[model samples]
Target: MSEKFEIRREVVVPGTPEQIWAAISAETAGWMFPSPLEIPADGSRPDSPIIADWEPPRELAIHMQGPDGWFNNLEYVVEARDESTAVVRYVHAGVFAEDWDNQYDGASKHTDFYLHSLGQYVQYFAGRPVTYVSAEGPEASSAPEAMGALRGALGIASGATAGDTVTVDVPGIGTVEAIIDYIDDWFVGLRTENALLRFYGRNAFGGNVDAAHHLFAADADGDAATAAWQAWLSGVFA
Candidate 1:
């Protein structure tokens, strides 16, 4: 139980550090976590990762030992890279105390997917980004299978490449306009006129697929958009 490993990921998005900072406030927590995680009260770390260091327009680092009880400290670091991009690094350093194989593998894929989603979402924040809306579907499939369900539902070919302007007929949302911004076996990202969306194909506890939705929106369109998208996702993954 002494073996250790690290899962590192980084990305560059289109914006200055200052801009990226704004996009990642409490509002965008949904884009990362499965739910909106309220920022812990100042100087308090109760099971949740404490905001160890935050130098806005530059770096934000939080220190926490989670997936808790796993005996590991995870640090999520963000570094601004000028006005057109930024980098995020997720460091998971700890002993392979238990379930190392599964935990490490999932962490590797998920960290990559989340970083990409966050970067894309931040690219079009519009200065008025609203709270993120999130939802999850079933726990009965693999990540690839979960992603396959979404692609099949949207009539998107696995061959679809980024930068393609495609329109998908969402089950309950009518026609939705989107530009494919990122695609991989484990995740797919889309840019809509009013928001950024993601199909996260991650494995959950029960060998089920963690089908998730993350969106960046405005106060006026938040509820409606969340309803429409969550409805469509339910239909697709249900």
Candidate 2:
């Protein structure tokens, strides 16, 4: 049997409604994943989807259904606070095939991180192109000390919190002075001069550790970044 889940989060950021809409729509790669948010040009359902709502600079919603009554939906309602700020109300609803509790917990927490990243992108790096590099650590990453080792490698102390400044020696990438943008037991976010670095302690959720880099430099090289990070992760978990 499948289980249903819905995650809602609201964020107030320094951007107009139009800007927020663009960030979530056309410029999603700046903060979220690399896939484009495609809306069908014909106004018809394709891939079992319906564009339930489409009001530019205000609201957008999409719903998709699977053959076995499984459905996933995304909705964003942007409200302008003034000329320079807006509030984004987002909802992510879906069904999971199994492991209902664990799935819901991970998905809900992931929403928080993604929304925080969205605010960061809108505030600082809005509309910039990004080269996203993701790497999975070795099997030993599931060990409890895996994330701690990576943090120690970056010179972050055990009790570090957001907003602390530190210089990071990024392996094969170069050294950078960064701010701890976000941190929790299962995640770490670093904001450098030109990139957002994210570390996922997925062992807390039954997976290996993962690292993702969102490089916003004009000359970013995704291939080299991925290769370097993968090697670093392998060494860390080995």
RMSD of each: 4.3, 2.7
TM-scores of the candidates in the order shown = 0.74, 0.91
Candidate 1 collision pairs: 15-83, 15-84, 16-83, 139-208, 140-208
Query: lDDT per residue, candidate 2, 24-133, as tens digits?
Result: 76666777677444635542332423677778878888888888889999999999988888988999999999989988888888789888888888888887878888
With a 3 Å backbone cut-off (N, CA, C), the pairs that clash in candidate 2 are none
Q: Which model scores highest in lDDT?
A: 2
TM match of model 2 to true structure = 0.91
Give the per-residue lDDT of model 1 (tens digit) for 172-221.
45687888887877677777776666776665322444334455444335
Q: Model 2, which residues run further than 4 Å from truth?
A: 36-50
Per-model CA lDDT versus the true structure:
0.61, 0.83
Evaluated at residue 85, the lDDT of candidate 1 is 70
Error of 2 at 209 (Å): 1.2
